[model samples]
Target: MSKRDLTDKGTISRKYAKKEILKTIIGYLVFYASWMIVTFWLLYFFEEIPHFDWILWILFYAVVIPFIVVLVSVTWYSYRYVKMFSFEVLESDIIIQHGVFNR
Candidate 1:
């Protein structure tokens, strides 16, 4: 089968699939690692405060949960968008198929 034929059958192009998976993993790891580093830095900087442990826990959850949720949502949306919008390497164009009728 042709490359285009494979993509049309809902099979991701191998090259694009590998690239997307790597990008997704790296994106997630970088985001979470940065958050962790910042959290620890803040905790250390504010060590003088009383009940800092409790405060840190509260702040960490308050900030990290929403951040994680938003990041995950955006990531998922990106993957879905990429999957739906087929890419043609030779033509250098993306075919974005939308709506139930189109499918």
Candidate 2:
């Protein structure tokens, strides 16, 4: 399928550069990794505290798993986004279209 916008001078439609996908993935990875480090560090710190042993398992199940799931979901979404993304330069305006949920 093609995403298009009409223009008097005709449309210049293009997909995002492949490098953009790599760049975005790297950025997200760095951000998530830092947060994850802090999260796990806190879990470790708390686990060392007296009577806080259960905090590790509880937080692991409640926080760590969800964070990992979100990370994977976002990565998949970004990859799909790069594949489907397109922009059309019209005579008077530009229209960009891409959606992971609805396209």
Candidate 3:
């Protein structure tokens, strides 16, 4: 909730936070740009692309489905990596923490 609490969890150095914030921003920008490209491509090529009879399903499955899958996959990685952080590192132990937002 606050900076103190966040620091209490782990030390996110300024350099690390700045780097990750840049990465997160760039990632979202890329996703937004891709979504724009897809939308515009579909809009401009609607008549050109053959839809047969299943227009709704075809449009969704052909364009939207793959985009959603890739977007989720990429965003998940970026989100997870956003906080340049470490939590309770044990002495020579092996583990990975699963979380979102890293609170």
lDDT of 3 at 20: 58
lDDT of 2 by residue, 1-103 (tens): 2335465332222234345555666675677577767876886788854346665675577666865776677667656666676665566675665433343
Model 3 clash count equals 0
* lDDT score, candidate 2: 0.59
lDDT of 1 by residue, 1-103 (tens): 2455433324344465457656766776787678767867886798844476776776577656765776677667656755565433333444434412233
Model 1, which residues run further than 4 Å from truth?
1-12, 48-103
RMSD (Å) per prediction: 7.3, 7.7, 10.1
Model 3 poorest ten-residue lDDT run: 1-10
Q: Ranking under lDDT, best-scoring first?
A: 2, 1, 3
Taking all chains together, each candidate's TM-score versus the true structure is 0.39, 0.43, 0.37
Candidate No. with top lDDT: 2
Per residue, candidate 3 scores C-alpha lDDT tens digits across 1-103 of: 3333332235334565456556656776677668767765886787565455665675567656866676666556555564534453344442234333334
Backbone-clash count (model 2): 0
Q: Cα deviation in Å at residue 12, candidate 1?
A: 5.0
List the global CA lDDT of all models. 0.58, 0.59, 0.55
What TM-score does candidate 1 get on C-alpha atoms?
Answer: 0.39
